[model samples]
Target: MTFQPAGATTIAAKTPASETARRNQPLQSFDLLVGPLSFSQATRRGLAFYLLSDGIAVWLATTGLVAQAFVLLGLSRLLAVAFGRLAAGRRSARRGLVAARRPWLEALLYLFTLAVVAAANGTGSFAASLSGFPASQALRVSAATAIDAAVGYLTVQGDGFFRVVTRGLLSLLKGLEAILTLTPWPVLFAVIGFAAWKRGGPMLLAVVWAALGYLGLFGYWAEALQTSALVLASLCVCLVIGIPVGILLAKSPVSRAIASPVLDLMQTMPSFVYLLPAVAFFSIGKPPALIATVIFALPPLVRLTCLGIEQVPLHVREAMQAHGATPLQTLLKAELPLALPSIRTGINQTIMMCLSMVVVAALIGGGGLGYNVLFALQNVQYGEGILAGLGIVFCAVLFDRLAGSGRKGGA
Candidate 1:
């Protein structure tokens, strides 16, 4: 029943749904090119080289036999490449051009790995060769011994210096602890409540008081004070060292590049790893605990400070210079002011991280809520451990909230 003009072409009675969608989105319509890709010149050459490498590797692995197999395999692989290259040249459209791909490289790795293991294990009648040995323990032992020797040497030579540093740290710890523990409880509560109210309003004030009340009611006030002292001491050390290092890194790309890997290592290294060197240098007690906490918590502040400084707007720096400001003045006024939020964030993160280490540091004679937790854990006292852990949590949050308070009263 259909009618058509004399020169008209026949049309499909029904268009497919896919075709209909493509018609609707004509600008976006395209075929997804899943690839068995057409070879480029580099790809052609790389394949040939890869085949040659494989042949050589196999020949070497076969132990003086099967060297001729390589020639046959190499010739066959090269011939395939040659035919592919010719077919590629005849093509007018590059239908299979694709993004970077090195599946062949991965294949090569697997082949080589298998070849190596076989050679090391001995191929049929071939004695195991001296090359490609992944199963050896002698090297590891020697390295461990060398490290131990170095640590021992350092321990012997640096005893006096370590002792002096330990004394200084212990004095600082005791001083802070004395002040915290000796202060009248009401005065301390008033100070905390007032600061909380001022910074975070009445809600924060209530939370702060509740946390403190838990510690006092459960007879954990003294331990809480000890934990705070540790955190505050560690915070001071972190700020003293971290800020300048951060500023230096921000200003100098070379220093930043060098320090970046070290910072990454510090942040990623297990907190327990620092404990050995700390214990060796400072011995067990508050000093070693402080050292461990400082190492554990130092990275965030440094990172944040550098990020803040780097994030300061370029125009602001230029404006400062335009006003005839010196480098110091520009940094002090323009950069630091603008970077304060980030810097404050860094400080708060450092405080929290510092608090977390308290429990771990307890393994090295760090007494406080952490000690209580550890003691309770050792005896399998669930109730005591949970209560002590809550005490630590309250201390952590209390400090974190205070640390996060805004300077301009809107935090």
Candidate 2:
């Protein structure tokens, strides 16, 4: 054993109670007093912006500066949302933090929507001036004249071309309708039932029968057939156009750049707006209605087709190329096969959208159960409208079952 010098020793000395208590005590830096919590940073900012914008808009409008409030709110809203969106990049990607659309655009939309709601709320004259956005009459007239002139030019100059188109579409539609309407009801029912049974099992078979029974019992079989034919015709046209366009979009960025905005306009524009061009080009008839329905239903198919092809695995494409596969061969054998499920989804959405256009189609002289609803609405026959509307719903279900029901992998 080694000895220590002076006061240092091997054995520990006993300490007084106070010294012992203080021996291993820790110094305090901070204390915790949990009680309540406020909104998170992002939440706080978003709420503040929403409140400030509404508050400031109300104050300004109340002060009788309507247009000024609109202009200033535009700026204040920008400020409120300046730090609202989290930084989105490769490193910062999180479940819901990243915006699918541009932040500024979304913020602007939010402001507009907020203003609209505030103005529209019952008796909320508090925000009454936000919705007044009248375009100049001269500008509106000029635009209308330009549109009319273009339509006249097309109608006059392209009459032969449009006639050919109309004839072709009409023939296809008529042929399908004739088949649906002229076929023996029993045969059609058996075929539909068998197909439904084979594809979707007993439950789907039952649903299909119920829907068909509704159509038959309600004396809507012929009209329902007409509606079905229209839907089928539109589907055929969409497939022919949408698949090729989708393939092109997947292969070429230029085509995508050109087509995407057009697709957006097609989708976002009111369904009624489609009737205008259809009427201008094809005139008011079944052909115009079909064209409008096709245009409205086409975008989803094209978009999904492009998405599916683009989503094909890089290595799968590489393998096909390595195997000396031509572009067409690779697309047919690999990409299309792999993308089948997505394409099927697109088709499903297209079918539903087509059905939705029934009433719209009726407005343009397309005949079907939609005509019944239109007729009822004209005369205020609530029972007829409700029954006809149900017929359309049943038709939608039937078409969806027949066209969209399949294996998940598109088998």
In candidate 1, what are the lDDT values of residues 1-411, reduced to their tens digit? Answer: 956445433333377765533333311001101111344333443545455556565766476544454554444444444444444434413443212232343344435544544454556544344343456689889998998899899999999999998998899999999999899999999999899888888778888899999999999999999999999999999999999999999999999999999999989999889899998878889999999999999999999999999999999999989999999999999898888888898899999999889889999998999999999999999999999999999998799778885443333
Candidate 2 local Cα displacement, residue 168, angstroms: 0.4
lDDT of 1 at 67: 46
> Candidate 2 — which pairs collide?
none
Clashes of 1: 0
Q: In lDDT terms, how accurate is model 2?
A: 0.79
Worst 10 residues of 1 by lDDT: 26-35
Candidate 1 segments whose C-alpha is farther than 4 A from its true place: 1-135, 406-411
Q: What C-alpha lDDT values do all the predictions have?
A: 0.77, 0.79
How many residue pairs clash (N, CA or C atoms closer than 3 angstroms) in each of the candidate models, in the order given? Answer: 0, 0
RMSD per model, one decimal: 12.4, 12.9
TM-score against native, each model: 0.71, 0.72
